[model samples]
Target: MGKSPSVGVLHEDDCDEVKFFEKPRKNLQSDDENVDGRPGWLPDGWIMEVYCDDDGTIYRYYICPLSGTTFTTKSEVLDYLFSEMDQCFLESKNHAVGSNLTRTHEWLPKGWLVEIRAGGDNMDKMYKFYVYPPNRVRLFSKDDVLIYIKEMKISGFDTDGQCNTNTQENILAILEFNPEGLPQGWVKEVVFRKTNTGKIRRDRHYTDPIKNYVFHTKRSAALYVETGKVTIRAFVQKTSVHEMYSFEKFTHLHESLWKRLELGGTNQLRTRLSKLRKLSLKEEILSDEQGSTSAEDCNSDNSDTAHGAGQNKVSHLASTTVKRPRGRPPKQGNARK
Candidate 1:
């Protein structure tokens, strides 16, 4: 197999190929495929290369075509690729990896942050790619990165507590990363916002921008030529709102709690709680004292009745005899009533 990670034996017909490989290609099957599951086809843009080592044992390799994945074997690449499960029922259940590589992305309303690195045990070898749905573009040269961010369909990228301007230059700096630009996510909507002409005209808006029309991430710089009036329709998704349960909760609570405490002239939450505790304790003590005084007064009032009344009281008792009917009765003392 070629040193390029895009190595695997797949039938040329089994997997989709790039427009560059228009001719017929060979199908290189791998032994590393699932035992029960049939071997999958090569992915488009990727090619399979096979060569025997000095020891005659056959080894298969799956390589990423856009390059830079450390998967040394076909099995490794298959594991990652099969997550999307390339299958076709019409092809006798033999679903090979075939994707429309040239298809534009159905851009999300927002963007995501993607981590890219060579496939394998390599960790330090990493690249960072950011996707801005506004442009339907990726900032790196890795297929897995593109596939990952698209599949994730993240609503938006994190601001990371830092506010960065989405200026025209900033967008261009990130999107147009040298080499050659790869167009993935498709831009479905493009509405032009005319300058300060009182109100936007209905028929003046445009949906399709010419191919050469440069795309920018910023909405304010919608117009290719800055007439100061905004021409492009750039609607950035609202920044994600921090929920009540988010860390902002603690920050907000901290301020409010401190303010409430400050009104009481105490600056500590613990001190405020302690004051409440003392008030509660004092109330409990007062209630206990009142209950004790009431009990004492009642006891003193009942003392006279309990003492002299005992002497005036008299006791009486009587024993009754029971008669048994004609029957064999027990020889014990007559039944007492």
Candidate 2:
């Protein structure tokens, strides 16, 4: 059996240096009330907080704007963002990515993240981080969209209360925004809006694709042609057709159009409106095509028709000229006076 090696006792001079001499004190101040309406236990640097009245749900939000990544204090959001970034870093980890790449220190709490920049020329481009099963932001998170609706209300832009809540959420994706992300005016050739019950109920409108005119039905589309106004009485029977009005000096590109309407429930009206829109669009296209052809294709045979029936009447008049005097010989009657 090997003899155990003797351990030597060291004096204070022989001991290794200890960098931290005393235990560190903990920060108990973080437990105080948070004015941001978040849980007191959650760490700081949460920029936005959300609540749901339906389920009494609360969501705390943090975002990395450079990567367009949002975190929900859930380990998963953070884990995904870091994993993707780290994977990119493994490929080409260059330190001097860009001078202009900004790092936000004040906005984030300690240990969440340090300054994140594009590591190299290859990675400087945005690494879009998407949240699975996106929450309300997936549908309606833009401030400009909400502001646009409010302005439309102030300007008296009214719609049939058919648009449900889901359709309005879709509309939020369509409302115009300037380059700076401020709401402008309504840009959709047709739009759906929220109603009293906060559910859009029906097909709000039909649109003339050619004129970009909004109306109530396929009949109303042509009604504009008949009366210079589109008064669709699909909902009301006695109201007069009114002229549509719009705001000026707003630039709304067609790129912002919503792909589909999100009907809250009972999509029967939506299906009918879609069929009507297709039929109306085809009719408009046919009319435009036929208008030019009908004018240019006049029959040339009509030019050969003669007007000699007057001469035959003149030949017959001589036989009846034996005192065909008219007006009852007024001069003879006047002699009584």
TM-score, each model?
0.27, 0.16
- lDDT of candidate 2 over 105-152, digit per residue (tens): 122112221110111232211111111122222211223234433563
For lDDT, the strongest prediction is 1
| Residue 120 in candidate 2, Cα distance off native in Å | 37
Which pairs of residues have clashing backbones in candidate 2?
Answer: 162-201, 162-202, 163-200, 164-199, 164-200, 165-199, 165-200
Give the residue spans of candidate 2 off by over 4 A: 1-46, 84-337
What C-alpha lDDT values do all the predictions have?
0.35, 0.34
lDDT of 2: 0.34
lDDT of residue 164 for candidate 2: 28
Candidate 1 local Cα displacement, residue 192, angstroms: 40
